[model samples]
Target: MTFSPTTLGTGIAGYNFLLRTRATQQAALANSPQVARDTEHFREKLKDIQTSDQLMEDRAMLRVALGAFGLEDDLDNKAFIKKILDSDLADSKSLANRLADKRYLAFAKAFNFAGESGPQLPDGKSAEDVTRDLAAIRTADDLLGNTSLLRATLKTFDLEGDIGNTFFLKKVLESDPTDPASFARRLADPRYAELAEAFDLSDKVKDRNTVYGFASVFADAAATLETPEDLLEDETLLTEALRVFGLENDVYRPDFLDSVLRSNLNDSTSFANQLEDKRYAALAGVFDFHEMAQAALAEEPFTSTLQSFVTTLNARSEPVTTSNDFFSDIKLMLETYKFFGLPSRSNQAGYVNRILNSDRSDPAAMIHGVTDGRYLALADAFRIEEPNTDRIYPPEFADQVVTNYLDRQFEISIGESDESMRVALSMERDLGKVIGNAKGNDSRWYGVMASNLLREVFETVFQLPDSFGTLDVDRQLKELKHRSESYFGTSALEDFTDPDRMEDLRRRYLMQSNLQSSATSSSASIVLSLLSRG
Candidate 1:
C-alpha cells in the first residue's frame, strides 16, 4: 500500500481522536488515587525530558507514531507527505508497518548507515555515547575546516602563516580527543617544537596573548630561528639577545646577565644598579658615564683646533701664479704649519729646497721630492695642489689637487685614512682627461664625471686587500658589477649626454662612496707600531 499526505492527515486525525478518548477516560478516573499518581508520574517525565533515558524513550515514541502514519516508506518528510496524499491505503496495519520501515530508514540514513540493519556500537554503548563520539568527530572537522580558528591557533605560536603545512595539518587532524598527551605529542614534533617551546605550550596555556608575548621574545633575538624549539634549546637566542643589548662582550656573570635581561627594560635605575654589581666589573669600562663624558669633553679642543685649521686653509690666498709667488705661499704655509705644531724646521727646509730646486714646470718632480710625512701633513693642511706629471698645470689639475688635499687632510684630522677614499681620489685625478673634456659644456658633465669617478672608485676600492679579511670582496665586486650593468648599462660614461642618466649615476656614486668611506679608515696603527719598533 502507498500513502499520501491525505492518508497521513487521516492518520493524524485518528491519533487525535485516540488522545481525546484517552483524555475522556482520564477525566472519568480523575477522583481515583491511581489516576492522581499516574498524573504525577507524567509530570515527572516532562520535567526529565533533557535526561538521556527520557530522550531515548521520546525518540522511540516518535518512531512508533511515524510508523502508524502510513508514510514511513519515504525518508524525506516532504516526499513522504507527497506520497501519502497521492496514495490510497486501505489496510491500517500494513500502512503502519511500511511507515515504520520508512522512519527506520530515515534514521539510518541520517546516522550514515545503509538501512535499518546498520552498524552499531558495542552492547554497552548507548545512543548518547555514539552521539558524543560524533560530536568529537565534528569538532575535529571544524578545527581543520575553519581557517580562521586554525590561523588564530597558529598565530598564538607565531606560526599563523604555516597553515598550508601538510605535516602540521596532519598532526593536528590525528590528535586524539580522549588522550590529553596526544596534543603534546603533536606539538612536540620537531617541526613545531620551536613554536611549542616559545609559547610554553607544553603545559596549559590559557591566554593567547601570553603565548604571543613569549614568541615575540624569541623572535626579537638576533639570529634567525630555525624552529620555535631553537629559542630554548640553542644558545644562539641567548647570545644574540645579549649582544643586541651590548652585554655580550664583557659580561662574565652569566646568571646575573640573564636576570637583568629578564627584568623590566624600562627601569633605568635597575639597569644602572645591575651595572654596579662587582660581577660586571668588566663592563664598568664601557658603562662608566663619567669617563665617557670626560673623553668626549677632551675631544672638543682637538675638534675646535681642526676646525680652525680648515678655516685658515680655506681662507689662504692662491699663490701659484709664478715660481716666486708659489715659494711665498709655501713660506706662509710653513709658518701656518709651525703655528699648528706640524712640521719641524728641518722638514720645512727640506720642503723649501725640494720646491726651489725641482723644475718649476714639473709638478710631479716637485711633489715627488716632498714625500716627508711632515711635508705631506702641511701640504694637505694648506690645501696645496700636487703638480701633475704634465709640465703645464691645467685648471682641472688644480681642482684635482685641491680635492685630494682636502680628502687627505680630513682623514688626518679624524686620525683615520680610508683606502677606498684614497682609491676614489686617485681615480678622480686619473679621470682628469674625461672630466676636462666634459667641463663647461653642460650640467651633465658633473654626472658623467661623478659616475666615472665612482666606477673607478668601486673597481679599485674593491680590489684592494681587505685589512680585516672579513669582507667578501669577490662577491661584492660581482654584485657591484651587476648593479653597474643594470643601472648604467655597458657604456655608462658614453651615455652621459642624457641628463636623467647622469643624475642617476651621480646619486649611485655618492651613495656608494659614502658607504665605503664609513667602513674604510686610513689609520695603519698596526703597521705604524711595527715600523716604530723596528
Candidate 2:
C-alpha cells in the first residue's frame, strides 16, 4: 500500500522497534534500567527529529535502527519502517553515509538475530531460532568490546540459495569497516556474486532499451571488471559487448565490426570489406547509406568513421546496382565525400562512366555532379579532355547550365562512384569557361591545350553520344540575355560580348578574376578609344 509522510507517533514507534530487535541494542539496554531509559530517550529525540517534511538521512537512520532491532515480526513495525524509507530527506550525502553505516549495517545483522531476546513464538521462531543465523554474523567486537568471528558464516554458507537474505550479505560486507579488501572479497564471493550480477544485469536491461543504451552495461563492467578471470572473461559477456559494435554476430553485416568503427576507420580491413562486399547488398532497397554517412560526417565523433566508409566505397570499383533509390544514394555519398575533402579520383571517373552507361538514363543526375564544386577545381587541375569532335554549344547555353546548376538546381551525390551526369557537365562547364575566357595573352591560355582537348571531347559527346545541335541554342541564348538583363538592369547585354568592347571586357574580366598581375595592352583600338573618349 502507498504511504504518506511519517507522524511523530510513527517515528517513535519505529525508533523503539529498532532498539528491541538489535542484539547489541537489546544487550546494551538490558545492561541496566539506565540503558532502557537511554533507549527511550533516544526514541523521544527521534520524535523531535521528525519535522514537517520527510528527510532522506532520517528515513535511512530509522530503517537501519529498526532492522537492527528485528521488528519484522509485526505489520505495524513494517508500516513504521516503510514511512521512514518513504520520507524525503533534505541531505543526500548525509543520508548516503548514514544509510551505508547505520541503517544498512544494523538491518543486515538483524537477520542473524544478534542481541535479541525472548522465547520461540507459536507463529514464528524466537531468539533461539536465530542461533544458526547469528552464527552467520561476521561480528568484529561485542558491546563489552572483544574481537570475535573473523570468517563467520560467510566462509561456509552457499549465499546463492539464500538470495532472499541480502540484508545479512550486505552486513557481512559492511561489518568489517577496517578491512575493505576483505570486504570486497566477501561481496564478490562467487555464489553471492552470481546472484548480484544477474540482478544488476536484469535491472540494467529494464532501464535502458536501445542497443546504444544497453551498451552502457558493458561500460559499467569496464569500470570495476577485476575478478576471477573466468566470469569477466566469459564469451557471453564479450559477445554482448561486441554486439554494440554493430556486429550482429555475423561477419557479413557491415555493422559486424567494432562500434569503434563509427569513430575509428584504421582499426580493420574487415570494415572496408563489408562496405565493399557486393554479396550482402542492402535489402531495404529504398534506404540510402549516404544519409547515415552524411550524419556521421556532420558530427565530429563520426567523422573518421564516415571517412573510412567512403574510402571503402571508393575501393569497391563496381557500381551498386542503380534503382531510383540506389542512384539517389550514390549521389548523396559523392556530395558528402567531397564536402569532407575526401574525393576519390578513380571512383569519380569510373562512377561517371557507369552512370552514362546505366540502363536508366537521367539527365538531372549530370547536373548534380558539376555543381558540387569539389571536382570543379579538379577539372581545371587535370585539364581532362573530351576526345576528337567539332561540336560546340553557344556560350549562353553553357552559361545557363552553369547558373542553374550553381543555384542549387539539384541535390548532391554522396558516394565515391565513377558515374555521375553532374560530374561530366561540371567537367564540360569548367572546361568551357576555361576556353571562353582564353586570350592570346590571358592566363586562361595556361590551359589552352587541355581546354582544346576537352572541347574536342565535348564535340565527340555531341556527335556520337548526344547531339549538341539538337539542344535549343537560340532559346538558351534568349534566356541567358533575359537573366543577364534582369540581374544587371536592362542594358546588361548591350555590347556585352562585342569585339569593339573586347579591350573593356578584357580589363573587366582581369579585374574580376583577382589576378595578381595587371593586364596591359598594346592594342591601338584600346589606346585610340581611350584617347577619343577623353
Worst 10 residues of 2 by lDDT: 410-419
- For model 2, what is the alpha-carbon lDDT of residue 358? 34
TM-score for all models, in order of appearance: 0.15, 0.16
Model 1 lDDT tens row, 1-534? 111111111122423333345334334433345433433343334323332233234533222223222222332454443333323233344332245223332222222111222222212233333333322222334455656445644654456667887466545555443344665344544435443432333222222112122223443342333222333345644443334223455335555553443333234555533554322222222122333335466764222222332344334433232334445556445434543234356666555545544553575777555533334333322233343321111112222222232333332222223333333223333344343334442322233223434445445333434341344645544455455566567333445445566545434544555555444433466667789999
Stretches of candidate 1 off by over 4 Å are: 1-456, 459-483, 496-503, 509-534
Root-mean-square deviation of candidate 1 = 47.1
- Count of clashing pairs, candidate 1: 18
lDDT of 2 by residue, 176-256 (tens): 323444443356555444333322332333322222232334443432332223222455544443333323344343334
lDDT winner: 1
lDDT of each: 0.37, 0.33
Q: Report RMSD for candidate 2.
A: 42.7
* Error at 39, model 2, angstroms: 20
Candidate 2 stretches with Cα past 4 Å from truth are 1-242, 245-302, 305-534
Query: How does candidate 1 score on lDDT?
Result: 0.37
